[model samples]
Target: MSFTTFLKSVPAFRSLATREVERLSSQCEPVAYPQGQQIIRKGDPGDAMYVIRRGEVKVPIVDEHGREKLVIRLGAGEFFGEMALLTGEPRNADVFAETEVECLVIRRKPLQDFLHKHTGVASFLTEILGRRLLEGDGIRTVGKYRLVGELGRGGMAHVFEGLHPQLNMAVAIKMLSHELVYDEEFASRFREEAKIMAGLKHENIVEVIDSEEAYATFFIIMEKVVGTVLSRMIDTRGVIPFDETRRILSQLASALDHAHTHGIIHRDIKPANVIIEESGRVKLMDFGIAKTQKEAEQEDEDIVGTAEYMSPEQALGRKMDGRADIYSLGILAYEMLTGRLPFDSPDPYEILRRHVRDEVPSPKLLNQRVPDDLAELVRRACAKKPEDRFQRCADIVKFLQQDAPAAIDLSKARAKVFTVIYDPEREEQVTGLFRRALAEARKIRGARISISDMNRIY
Candidate 1:
């Protein structure tokens, strides 16, 4: 098929203006493959989407027993790898040329250029995105908990410090945000994930005390860590002292290894997920996107991961295991030691592309104090190819322990408290001001506030 013909074949592309189409067609490359040639492998990084100009391609998957199954067949004008091309993720299924195949490859640059030239297409794209989002409620806060205070909020969920009044004890309840709950599929998967995590028991992993679906809300109860998150610790204290960072990371590695042994991969492993308690205990949390190796391969491709910490295979939408998590951990370790991410880009797709193609630079190159051995460790852990990376979480843990004398001190690191003093005269003035404000607020329906003494506010 000619490049122009192939462009017309795509629904989304057809919406583009003629001038935009001409711009892209100029950059398209015509390619051909013989029967039995692999166009894209499940684990390989994807640079562009392929449009079938001629012949046929077969999408193949392997069952648990390793038997090959042909899932879908594509013919002329059909396209595969659309998601991968947009997100810079890997192919989820292997595509093989079933017959002499001719294709027009619309690499990332040309498509991006075309889109830039056609802003009208952006609105059409937004409408498509809106339809996908409208499919579900996303995540919702369905139940009520004593709003003790904000414990933390990440990209996906909110953590709250709450009191289980009936039990007369304090516990942390993490509720999936309304946006996440709205997607019924994500919500259902999240509930199942909680169940799967509940079956896991380990000293390092934070225990999942209880989970319940109440009033159309999904909540997971967990033990609260009294200290700060690793991100904050790194920010406040600077790169953890080598010995201390190693110790804390070793604990993390041990905890991750335990999860992997049980077939759980913590797909997201940035510093924020690793919590350091006052007692020096390290706990891993947030398994919303984590999945077992077997489970991950069985589903449709999902590009739901933090770009900075995502493994190349994960970014590409390929089946992943513990190694993927290991890659993320390596990124965290590099950031902790150097105080900067290995790659930086304003666009997430660009960052993902870098992850897929760029080599992880040495940590020592950025921070002169970083030891050679530590730099080498980070490089190996962040290797673009899964096979070239650490074979397991345990392996990286072992290396960190032996290489770094100063490890992350979960015990020494504690959350800071800022105290403010209030004067009696100032308190009275504040009370008077608040009373007037409340009187006005009361006029507005659905207004609410808690009354407390001025001294208590301090």
Candidate 2:
């Protein structure tokens, strides 16, 4: 078929007049990619859209863990990259030639000009794009659960707030990214995460309710935790009180101890993965990278976990055990008491380097109010050598409960709670006031101020 005829067959250009199609076809440059060559990579600048003229191409989604999954395969007359081209955004997926592929590439400037000259065609194309976006991996329901809203996204999956109509219960649904469902390895890993969580039952750990494959993807339903994430609490209320920090750390340690007993190591343990209930209960979550002790012994060597909280051995991709979790828990403890990470940098590698090599500064130096015994515990828990650190999570828990001293000056350690009542209309002004207040409070040594409540006066 002639290029002009082929262009007319494409859904996006079907509305164009014959003469307009011919003009657009004249601007299209034919290009060929050898088999296995990358045509477009994720995050690359999108300058043009491609229409497969002959042979086939495969679209793959690559996650942060360096795992790739085939998203779709496009044959002759099929199109890709239009969304990125129209929105001027980076390519969202990688495209590679399945065979010796010939494609008609339409550059941005000419396409924009052509669309401007054909308003009706532009409208039709917009409608098609909207439909494609809505139909592409945008699942609204899974099995008996109806997903209501997105809670958050991690490296491997997107978590949604879901509801069951029959039970009238709310649940958190962790859906493996639609792009990753096709890869057996990723799917199995996701199932393994669910299996691990389901097997371990503890008060401090978030419980897995069910796991299902629906809408061609895998999702794990978990008990919906209604509370604030620990990270948000740390951000809003800097330098948590010694009592609260000890309680939180103790609960986390107990949870880790249970998992470790079962031969599971929660490879990722950070404040963001912990939710604090109003009743002072801590629920640990997101076992996306959790591995068994046996799995750790194998030479997989995939360094995973947040850089800021990574243990020394984890940063080096060395074999880890329950002691690794203790190390991470120690980092969390340092952040909780000091209101800052022991090692932080814009570059992740630098942070990892510090975790592996640098000696952690004493927590007492960062926050003078930190009890001497607690500071010593933090230092020992974060020891560079695994053997030097707390051998078990229970040891840390016991130390926090029995050995850690109470604050010498309770008056200085206690945070003054303030409740601000304001008209709902003055929210912006009140928010600005709070920001200024926080900024000023940070300047004062050992001074910590946080807005505990905001009540609206009708």
Candidate 3:
């Protein structure tokens, strides 16, 4: 098939006017591949979306162990790289020629320009996107979580409200979107996120009960609650009451602090990631884009974060840390107190650009009702330079608890570490009122080594 003929058959281009299709065809660069040639590499920057004009190409599922299996094949009129091209993200999979193949590659800029002018083109792609392969039969079960109903769909996964068959306990099941299961890099990351969340146990962090790599999908079971996401509250109430905001901030800060201590940095921390339970408990959810201390992925054209809450380093694709999360928390705090972001503008990209170079306005300037001290805290927490922000997320909780009772000051309540010199002959099982505080002891050749830090490390 010729490039124009293939475009005509593509559902997205089918709706386009003859002139528009011609324009796209003129902008397309015809590319050819011999049988078994590698086309797209997973994790490489995607600059264009490709349409198959002749022959076939296969997307092989490659595992972390370096094994590969053929997952899907594309023929004439079919397209790939839509997600990468649309979001300007790295390629999520590897494509190889199944046979001698010919393709028409439309670069991102021209494709974006065309998409802007032809709105229905996006609608057509939406239809293709919504067609998840395994959803055809409707997945009814994954591991022990029996799916009751669909809770919601996120960018990369579909969440389901479910229950345990035996325990009869309520749970939320999150499954990686079927389409992404074939993209092993994404699938591995999806599983890794569950592992990270599983390691985190805190009152303010959502609990991960289980994670499984089922035959058809990867799913995670988590504790569920009947309540609303914080985003909805902010939407309905404009701004949260100052006292309520402080309480919520304390919980969120603690959650971030705990994760940081555990060597996890949640790259996304907008209100939508926070769930407010009926019991008034705050549960931070989703570590989908989080980076752990051991993650070796380099930064540079690999920016991945929500634009509104992105920190300066995140927006610029620079190295990030727990301080990046602090910046996001400040944005969340400012929004809760002022009912608006400090970097609001008509253009979204400009908002991101502002976070990189613009100064954060004092929250009090937006709402006089905001306390001056709180306003200053917000400004400092959101400074463009990470060093200017709160050095630790625990500091945010400490700042909020300044007026609380001395007992509520977590720093004062911090568990104490002690140096215990013990001889094998003298050791007769130690016990005291500090039993709970008596953390770990390392058994040496003839004695025990005292814990330098308590068991409650976080």
Candidate 4:
């Protein structure tokens, strides 16, 4: 099929006048692919949404067993991946060529520009989006806890803000959504493990106030936290101060240590699971799939956990202990210190491969401000071999509290390493720029050069 034919089928372009279509067509490049090629993969930052002009493609989601489940197939004129234009979240599914295919790929930036330039076009798309949002089958939960509002939603469940009426307190409830409950194994496992969570009592762990099977839905009521999540805090303020980060980690390590003593392993530990409460306290939550020492994978071969935060063993589907949680914590620390994950890849399989086989770059590699001692701590925490990591949660707690060895060299880890040397050319350049800036400053009459400026010049 020709690009022209493809444009006619696209809803976004269908109503465009011939002249407008021609204008848009000139901006797009015609691209083709062979059969079985992957157009996109899960965890990839969606850059563009494509319009299928010819052939077909299959959209597959990663199932619990690390296998692919074909969710839908797209043919000529059909569009998918519209979400790419809005949220920068990773693509949720993988798109593969079912046969040799051709597509009109429209990048987000260009499409955004086109919409803005054409007010009528923009309004039409907005109306379409507003209608879709209104028609969305968002889960409607009965307010056992007075529903304040929604917190957030993921593939597993929709978190909500609610008030415990009798208790007269605010709390967040992670109610298992209908779709999530559809997976009998997941639902059963969640209910079974929830019983163990009831026994968990620790300051650092989010208190599981209540667990109930209400309205045919399994729900876990947890303490409501009002402060920023670790993930968001890191994004807004890159690489927290060493002292602050250490304090937070120390608290979490203590919590994990307590949980471990009770024979419970938090198999999934990530930034999202670790909440920084309003009063500057840290609390770990989400034990829905956590494995207890006495428990087994009870017939449910489905994989559960975030790919970005999974430990090497968890990624390989091996039986994991508390060490898995330690590894995840290490990854979180690495991310917090350096504004990026230890590894990156569009393919989940590829990402897992790197986790198992690749060497993670030291935190100092990306951010020079990272102390060598802190980087070493992160390295030990993320070591591929569980034995190589801080063997006990107590050890991590000690390290964070300044009680561990101080052998790490922070100077080498800093980004810009400069030797104390005299260089005439460099000195002159620096002095020239400084003197010029100083003269301009003096012209303002309200400013004066400091003694430090004379020392720098001399």
Q: Model 2, 239-272: lDDT tens per residue?
A: 9877678789999999999999999999899999
Q: Can you give the TM-score per candidate against the true fold?
A: 0.56, 0.62, 0.60, 0.56
lDDT digits (tens) for residues 1-458 of candidate 4: 55655576677666556555665565566569799999898889987777777899998766789786546788988766666765445787788899999887767777666654543333223323322333433223334675667687665665767678788898877767533454566678778656766788888888777766653357777777777788888888777766557768888889899888898888778787787877879988788778776553332245567777778888887767788888888888888878789887788778888888887789998888776677988899889998899988988987765643244465653332223344666888777766676545543322223524333444
Any runs in candidate 3 off by more than 4 Å, and if so which?
1-139, 405-458
Worst 10 residues of 1 by lDDT: 124-133
Among residues 3 or more apart in sequence or in different chains, the pairs in candidate 3 whose N, CA or C atoms overlap within 3 Å are none
lDDT (10s digit) by residue, model 3, range 48-162: 8788888999987767776885488899888787655434668878999999998888787776666555433333343333332225433356666667776877557777778
**Cα lDDT, all candidates:** 0.72, 0.81, 0.76, 0.71
RMSD values, in order shown: 19.9, 14.6, 18.6, 18.5
Better of 1 and 3 by lDDT: 3
Model 4 scores worst on lDDT over the 10 consecutive residues at 122-131
Q: Give the worst 10-residue stretch by lDDT in candidate 2.
A: 119-128
The better candidate by TM-score, 2 or 3, is 2
How far in Å is the alpha carbon of 228 misplaced in model 4? 0.5
lDDT of 1 by residue, 1-458 (tens): 45666676666567556665666577678899999998988877867778788899998768877688546799987777654433466666789999999988768655555554443333323222222222342212224344355576554455666666567566777766433454567778789768767877877787777775542246787766677889988888666656556667788889989989988888889888788888778888778787876876664466888899988888988888889888998899899988889888889999999999998888888788776767787888888888898898889777876654343476664443323366776877776777677555544333334555534651
